[model samples]
Target: MVTRILSENEQDLRLAGEIIAAGGLVAFPTETVYGLGANALDPDAVRKIYEAKGRPSDNPTIVHIADESALKQLTWRVTPDMQRLARKYWPGPLTMVVPRRDTVPNVTTGNLDTVGVRMPDHVTARALIQAAGCPIAAPSANLSGKPSPTTVEHVIDDMDGRIDAIIRSTPCTIGIESTVIDMTGELPMILRPGFITREDVARTLGKDILVDPTLNEKPEPGVEFRPKAPGMKYKHYAPEADMIIFEGETEAVEAAMDEERAERESLGQKVVVIRYSQEDTETAAHEFFAALREADKDKADIILAAALPQEGIGFSVMNRMLKSAGYNVRKV
Candidate 1:
């Protein structure tokens, strides 16, 4: 398929929306990450998203809405807790999983009775959804297990020919997937962490929050586990090169990187080093995926990265990093 690159103009946006309305895939930007989208109400359209990304059906897609009123059509019931979260974090990087209405296809919800939904803050994302006249079920616009695309170029890298069209726009601001919270239970549980920290949600609803245990570490060596949301059951946000992480005091980690770089250079191996200061957690969050893509662009044989402090948004960054490296870490 010849994939067309659509610019962020009225005509282009309309064209992208028309493709979506017609049950074709369109990759567009959101505040969190670029998402490859299809009409959420169309199961066949939603299937194309999985085929395009080679994503497993068990890993569900998040439904993107243009407005809060659209939630009623997708979910069975919207409780007061759901309303508080929507008011606080909608039009931003937060996904709420609630009981799905019969209208929401089992395929879109990964055969579960619940669906994850969110309203993106990006103007073009909202415009495309409104023009399409339907809620869009989308996942990060990258090949399954590869780094999530944050820029139009990155989207083109993994999805240009695979998808119907791409809406070229500004780089994603949050540069990661949204925080996913499950609202089906009385005590809200966070299935994934992102820029919206635990404190942010707790403070908003004035109640304690429960976090999914799988987010911090993998399940037992031989335990059976199934993830309820995307990015949980799969090895995601990885790059082409083999990535290894060095964790320790800042000075020691940097010194180990220097030594490794020298050794690899002597062996005529291309090396990419990604290290960020402890205070640069926000910057790390923004550039982590892009840096992985850069390493791939350089055709690096190996990638060596310094671990982010697992506090604040760094937890999200570390989560992606560990997965990208396949949990290959050495404490220096």
Candidate 2:
């Protein structure tokens, strides 16, 4: 895998931008995580994203920009609440699903009338987008079914000249995907969760954003629930190995992981266990999937993860990990 260390400079940004403009993939950073980017305006370029990630053609990519002006090119309708959220959260870890403009390719919007867009706060990504002169369609810089890469090394390991370049980011600030909300629906709906929460968007809108039931299932067609973004329809951010997690309330999950750990240890099989740790590290939700992904790499046969509290960042990360790992995912 070819890896390039990037400094915040015009030269590297220009190189990455040139690749995007010329219809190639580039991996760059955002506050949330690194993304594999291509020119959003070019369907051919956008198709390369699915090719690189081994992502299904039906699963769309999010359009990322440096500034709010680029949003004008992708979305036809941005509501007042959407504006408020964008003003406060853009250039950060949030993705808004708004009505797609004619310029937005159907592939980029997953054939949905709505499009997913974000203004990444990372200097490297912003500079590259500015130099490229168009919105960049980006998904997590990893294989389609694996965990999202949070570091430059992760991107290089999974996708190296399958892309144009890798911009060495200063480690991901959020260590997960962006919070995705769909304003195109009758009520705002959270398609995916991250650093931004449903409560956070609800507080901004002064009304609760509806949570979709489809989130609990595999990404399949003809499902009864409505979806606005690509992540909603597929499993994502998973590890290479099989991972099973305990669901529901925190204490029950803890006991489940504990019992699984004891049982496996007795069988002499090395196991990786994840439980909520308040003092040892970041919130439980954020670290659980990372642990599972890490465990999968070490050849651990089993991963026991516990569900976190509904409050704060815990809820968002847990939901993503569980979905990515797939359900019927043994209740640890």
Candidate 3:
């Protein structure tokens, strides 16, 4: 069994930092989500991230830093857009993909010349990074292919002995990973969408932020091109149960889900309906599924979600929904 401790003091923070300094893994909270962090510069320490999370070696981890100056340690060739975006969104939920330096291990960048980096706003995470004095390569603090843990409890559920220590915190405020934009490409493009939409990035850059159709998973026929991003490829952010996301008008979609729920009930299987944030202000896209977890706390049969509007940040929200649902879309 794993020993679970709630760390909320200076001494515990120091201890957690020490564990990271010594090249051990630490599951700590970030503004976006909890991340499994290890020394980004050390191959051995970085490899532990692989063994513990069972993450694919090809899947790159983001470098968590305390400040912009930390960027010098791992990368260079920063663009003016990178500077503006960094000044605006650093210390929050934004990841900038930039050209890598020789110091960044191949393990951290997935052998690519570019690396995704961010300065997190979470205090414990920043402290650990400051204490360790190096960018910590981290990904969501769960086994590679599961829903990213947004709470410390979820971290404990997925990682305990697998890491050296856990810096627990409340459920993530952002409740989603950063918007990962690749500047290395010809045009600035959003590789993954979070609270920061492509429009936001475009508006900031004074140029159109080109969006690849690959960002959204279309389950229709005549599909040939491949997505150039990571989050677009796999079944991610999924809980133990199965999930489906409904697409169309809200009322009509809800009606479809009610029927889907009835079908599951008739089949003697539990079902959950995930409506859009527009339906309930209290259940914003960020906390929609997390809120429903209690209703299905006993491990229900499946999760079916109604497609959320692309308006506002709901677009990014739906990306996580459909991805987690594993492209489970049904026509009513």
Candidate 4:
């Protein structure tokens, strides 16, 4: 199938929406990453997204809405805290998982009664949703388990023949997936980290939030945990090369990465080293996935990445690094 590359204009957005309304797939930009979208209410359309990305059916997708009013269609009830969060973080890089209404297909929720929902800040995304006249269920528009696409070129590399169309736009500003928060419990639990830090959420709600213990730890072997949200039970954000992360003080980590690079190069192996400065955690988060894509493009044999400090948004950046390297790490 030939995939149409559409411009980020009113005419093309309407066309993209029509494709989605007709049960076809459309990849469009969001503040975080490009999302392969389909009508959330259409079970068959949602299935197409899984098939296009080769994503596991058990992993849920986030429903994107144009406004808060769309929540009634995707979720059963909206709590006071949910309202508070929506007021503060809507049209931003944050996802809230809540009880799903019957109208929302089980396929979209990974057979769970809860669905993840977010209002993306991108104007093209909102316009597409409005034109489609339905909530859109979307995951990052990349092949399953690969680095999520932040630019249209990245989306085309993975989804060209596999999807119906793509909105060719600028690179994503956040350059990672949205922070996923489960609102079902007494205390909100962060299943995935992103630009929206836990501190930001807590400050907005005037209550403490919990981080998923597994967010920083390797998954237990031989255990099957059905995820309530994306990135919970999946091996995601990986590159093609064998990758390892070095964690410690900045100097130590850099020295270790340099040593590894020289040793590998001496052995006639191509190596890629990725280490951001101490003060550029936001830049680190923005460029991490793109750098991984570059490594794959260069066909490096091994990738050595310096670990980020685990505080604030740095924690989120580190979380992606760990998953991309499959929890392979060496502390100096």
Q: Could you give candidate 3's per-residue lDDT for residues 1-332 as a string of tens digits? A: 25345485777877777777798888888878888889899989999988998877777889999999888777778778889998888888888888899889988877888888899988878988887777899988888777777788777877877777788777788787888888887789788888778878888888988766666665565654333344655557667787777787767888888888899999999777666557443246558546444434767788877776765577788777777777778755
Clashing pairs in 1: none
TM-scores, all candidates, are 0.97, 0.89, 0.91, 0.99
| Clashes (N, CA, C under 3 Å) per candidate | 0, 1, 3, 0
Q: Order of all candidates by TM-score, from best down to worst?
A: 4, 1, 3, 2
RMSD of each predicted structure: 1.2, 2.8, 2.7, 0.7
lDDT: the better of candidates 1 and 3? 1
User: Over the stretch 1-332, how does candidate 4's per-residue lDDT look in tens digits?
Assistant: 99999998888988998999999999999989999999999999999999999999999999999999888888778999999999999989999999999999999999998999999999999999999999999999999999999988999999989989999999999998999999999999999998999999989988999999889799999999899889988889999999999989888888888888999999999899898987799999899999999999999999999888888889999999999999999999
lDDT of 3: 0.77
lDDT of each: 0.91, 0.76, 0.77, 0.93
Best-matching candidate per lDDT: 4
Off by over 4 Å in 2: 1-5, 217-227, 247-256, 278-282, 328-332
Q: After superposition, how far is residue 201 of candidate 2 from its true place, in Å?
A: 1.3
lDDT string for model 1 (152-202, tens) is: 999998987898999989899889889999998989998998999888999
Q: Write the per-residue lDDT of candidate 2 for residues 180-232, one digit (tens) a residue.
A: 88787689888777788888888877897887766555556565543466566
Which has the greatest TM-score?
A: 4
TM-score: model 3 vs. ground truth: 0.91
